[model samples]
Target: MKRRTRLVSIVLAAVMLLLSACNINMGESKEPAKGTDSGPKTEVGAQKVVFWHAMGGATTKVVDQLVANFNASQDKVQVEAVYQGTYDDLLSKLKASMGTNEGPSVVQMYEIGSRFMIDSKLITPMQEFIDADQWDVSQLEPNISGYYTFENQLYSMPFNSSNPILYYNKDLFKDAGLDPESPPRTFEELKIAADTISKKGKAVGANFAIYGWFMEQLFANQGAEYVNNGNGRDDLATESLVNTEAGVKVLTWWKDLIDSKAANNLGRKTDDSKKAFSAGQVAMILDSTAALKGLVDSADGKFEVGTGFLPKPEGAGEGGVIVGGASLWMMNSRPEAEQKAAWEFIKFLTSPSEQAYWHINTGYFPITTKAYEEESVKENLKKFPQFQTAIDQLHQTKLVKATQGAVMGVFPEARQIVEGAIEEVLNNKKSPQQALDDAAKEITAKIQDYNRTVK
Candidate 1:
């Protein structure tokens, strides 16, 4: 009986040992299985960057093609271009997005928004990157570079820079008994031609769809400084020469044009003005060269169009017209790698070939000198001589200065005030001097408020 009991205990001990070994094996198997289930990790590649732009239509297509080409050219980066609406919409969206940390890596900013962006600290100075890369900025046009520089440091790169040019309908000019080939070279000649066309032509003699652009060019052509110290970055307390003799003269001329029915005052919207011109309601227009493509498209081969340099004030001498176009600004919310990639994409977009393509396709002036020298651009220019009008005007400009391009904070609001003043004068509600003086005072007050906040 004792031997049988001992055998039973030995068998139970062996069974317990086997159970313990099985448990040990099961525990060891779990770790390898867990690790294998985790799967192979993906190595993160080039950072993806998002850019917000206010370009659409053919311009957007060009941008898409460029982005695709850039991505295909390199495996280290991918750039995505997003259309964020008009210039005003972009600004509003950007201001709203400031509260959140979800802004884009890059943004296309308007010329007037430069000061506001700088004051808000929303943009990263591009000069830092240029310095770090040891880039040859000398290759860029000095006037274009000057447009983007703030306190000697460039905050953005001028991408689609353009100046206003005079576009006339050749058929209308001939009908008005004016030389079709001889465009107005002076404001006096423009007034005469406009008066003649108003009597004979089917539409208004002359029109300027964009008031701020017209005022900028008018001030520059008259050799009048919009702000003191030559740099537009100064304070409102400094002085506002916008109501000076030259200003009053230009304002009066605009009033005379409207009063005489030589020119019609279309609403402030670009589309309104474009519609009027396209429908042959306006014989001539002073508008951005960027609109050349749209004008041609709208013409439908119905009229012979001629583009020429903007007419200057009589005896004002040759002066530069301020550039009016969008610029690419680097946002502060991006990572360093993404910022570098954004810069690379900017370089690609501004490359000679790319600039040429854009200029030919969109009618925007090439931002780089190399583009002007490209064989493709030359051939294209030969085919469309009007394409060179913007370039010629830009080259002929003298003494590039900030006074030519007003960069005051709250300039967008100031422009609205000025436009209101212009409307008042056009509607005969106020005299030219009164309207402009009121506008000047209002703009100065806004500038003061902006300066106080920024300071």
Candidate 2:
């Protein structure tokens, strides 16, 4: 096999100059592109680049616009975008495509897929391209970028960035005799508020996705690393530290939510809990910032949507939320021309105008700082005031390896083991301490297994 060492560079001045062409018309004259054509694209000849992603429906609409904008702006690159199902499905297909030589030139990689992608050795770091071109990355969000940085280098281009935030129903709050404007900011306050809602019977107090993602958020919020070796940013992780003081406290607190009937326990299925929020079955919920648009559409004007940052543990301060969502990874083992063209398309996608357009259409956090100042973003924020909650969460986050999350090769597997423990606690089958201890052992073995293979 041959190694492709060539990487493309971008001129910041020229990229800024291209901003005018990237200006997204709130309503473009041409009909917006659909699934697959989203931020990922495909086309025939003329330096074709096939983009595979895991976005559909509403998200797809915005992706189409981005791809259309990029393809229309240049003649040398004809990009074809395809929707490849959920992130898991995309990862599976991507892994399977390794031997096919006909794989996509670019792919949308979920943040959790970071280690697997790097281990697969099929990707070319976005840093290489930036360094090759001497492009300034000052515009990228630092905390968000931290999630992808490993061994002092960025591994992918952050895209569709999001983080967990508290979503509450204003109508339910008012009905429960609570102030809709003042949401809970700490665990004690959250319990009080939920207790009020539960007793008032306006709605089920709240619902939680019985998953490890929020656990990771809670750990980060209190400045606790999910894995050893500085959460794998300093070096490869060797074990799971998810049974720490912060982790145990979070587990106990979440279990208390169910025990007190303050939170609906919907197993490990996030979508089921999401539907519960949209159906107005719960007064409050914790979910991703990217869910705002779908949630608004689902509520259908039945009630006012409200947002707030995730509640923190007592005595925790200045801690922060980690960035979720996916990023763009340029695959290697291809022609240098295609690699350059892919980088070109990626540069356009991350530009200010495109980011603002993406933010308005998809409720994703804009990667470019200047995107917030763009007219389109301003107008969208005015129209959807609730969005300010997510923006604030993004701005307030401090860069820490804990917030950036674990970077181990078995991170996905680690998440599953932790989620299983959560299931045990919620179902009254095990105590938080016991469940967490058991999960830690299993995850440790998995990590050790991986390290042995890699070594």
Candidate 3:
């Protein structure tokens, strides 16, 4: 009995030792315990920072890879990327979060919302951070970051910047007896080609995905001021100037296309318009360059896609298409350390390699000059020269005034009013001048109400 008891005691001691060794290894392999600084202690570190964005698919993958690269490149920062839905959804969430002080450290915002973000004070001025870091602003494209600047202060960093382009189905174009290599350069040419294609029953004429963007580009191309002083900023009177001779002319042209059955209302939804184009239901589409990946994917090697510069007004001079894409806005609600981390992440994202990746993957123009100089970008550009169309357009931009691209306040509602006006004109419910005049009045009222609140 004594021998057996000694043996049992030896076995229990061995088992306990084994368990102790295993526990030590497990602890080392696992993350540091809460409140415990298991890794190297570093100054100016954040525990974790959250970023809210609306990017998805290939773009989302690119963002994820960038986040992973950033996390791996640093020891003191960990970033959590959260998808917050569409642009509107992101704004709604931001507003709600601000009310409760629960917003993310960074948010991806659309260009139209830049004014609102600046006015709300929801974002911090990025210029201060850039100056403090002594970052190389020269590495970026000139005035590329300026799109998000309001009142001479940079509120956000340009991320996925893009402009509308004319995408055509090569197969459809050929079927309609149009040369795929030679795209329409003027509105009249586009109309003629669209009419021919529609007559051939190969597809509907030309359809625009975003009516607002199309209108903006049309106005710019024709040197028509959408707002007084050509800036889309300031008071109601300034914005109401969109109800002008040039504006009426553009709207009238749109109405004529629909009235002649050369074009059809593909609906305001971008996806629907894309589907129509991909399925050969529509031969031509004016949409963001960002949609290239989707169109390519959905094409599934069935159709050849061609991209070209947006069609110009018949007598319009060289003009720039307004930039339309999202930017990265750093939130003020986060801890200073987290804010710094967020800035670092932003830098990583805007790095040349990341920008190249984003541009190649999403069809968005790279905001960094280094990205344009990179070999990968050069190779892609060599193969697809049309990809540089947006950059070329930017070079000729005059940037008339804030009201041209800096309208804040009730823009979302105002856009709806404008769209309604577009619908009325297209459907012949009202003439272009009458429709735009009515829209201007409605939009003016909304702007007044918004100004009252802000004042």
Candidate 4:
């Protein structure tokens, strides 16, 4: 009990630290773009729709532009886009505003929140809108949308989808006498490459941020379940599979790199590790496809950036990545007219042209396959082919429970626990197996607590 209490305290501290750095003013709204016209005057009696989103930094600008375009393209709906802080903050605020007018007509939530959103019964599933309009969901990328679909029903509209890929410094690989074209495909090969690079004095061989999301992706890539009961897809999960053989192998490989001095322990912030890679401090790193643009730009004139599939253990089979990103969900408590207006805005934001602009500006996938056909998308792809790796990896992923991803009401806390376990292993405070065993047990208890309350 003392150990569990300590873990919870650590997790809460981590959450507070992250929230302090990321949370923003809830009243923030986008400024109108300069040199852009508002297209047409809004129709009198236009339905007002409020949209709450968690987009931050430059991506927030793109989201604002998308909303601006949507409002200008039509006169019947006046949609107001508001920045609602980080994903954690947004969800918490939504809960606080339940049954109140302060809540939004539509909200963008992180992917892991699906189970909680569904169980809350506060959302109007996107499936209903699709069915009402006879909308063709087949147009969207199935692998990307697969994560939001539960019980054969899509609970939300996929947006800004991404997955992890291996980013390496080609110049470092060349300096280490390795082929720049062929990246390490398996765990053993990656370790060897890292050692070679370190031994050659080119750069630290690698540094994977101790991110829990990466842990989940690694488990899926090995066809391993992060939790039991079919990765929480078939039913509510009763246990975690974090201590499975696949989990141990992955952690062992990660620790091997650090132990041999081939990889540096850059801690939990992925951005710090990314900076290390861009500054030539590391030869390789694992990051989201959404970082492609920034990475390529940062490495400009320094080194050629190379991207590869997320490496797996030797002989692992039939595994692939789960989509990672946020999705749009409609609020059921809103009036029918507001709900319909929000649906129009959703469709407009996901249109081919908008998605192309989004794809080029942000490294997120277009979600709609047709977005690839846009001229801007084609030109962007031609300019930076590394982006193709993310798309290809997504398309190649097999749609299954493991890849579909685990769902749970307590996912946010569970992630912190898993990350803590990883930290314990990397710090040599606990063996990999022991750390995972503890995390799985702790998470299962949290799940049980959550299950009891929700029931």
- Against the reference, the lDDT scores of all candidates come to 0.78, 0.84, 0.75, 0.90
| Best of the two (1, 4) by lDDT | 4
Best by TM-score: 4
TM-score: model 2 vs. ground truth? 0.88
Candidate 4: list runs displaced more than 4 Å: 1-43
> Arrange candidates by lDDT, highest first: which order?
4, 2, 1, 3
Better of 1 and 3 by lDDT: 1
Evaluated at residue 287, the lDDT of candidate 2 is 89
| Runs off by more than 4 Å, candidate 3 | 1-46, 229-238, 382-385, 402-404
TM-score of 3: 0.84
> Between the candidate structures 3 and 4, which one is better when assessed by TM-score?
4
The better candidate by TM-score, 2 or 3, is 2
Better of 3 and 4 by lDDT: 4
Q: Which candidate leads the pack in lDDT?
A: 4
How many residue pairs in model 1 have overlapping backbones?
0
Task: Compute each candidate's TM-score over C-alphas.
Answer: 0.86, 0.88, 0.84, 0.90
How would you encode candidate 4's per-residue C-alpha lDDT over 350-442 as one tens digit per residue? 789999988899889998889999998999999999988988889899998899999999999999999999999999999999999999999
- RMSD per prediction, one decimal? 9.5, 12.5, 5.9, 14.6
- Please give the lDDT score at residue 292 for candidate 2: 87
C-alpha RMSD between model 2 and the true structure: 12.5
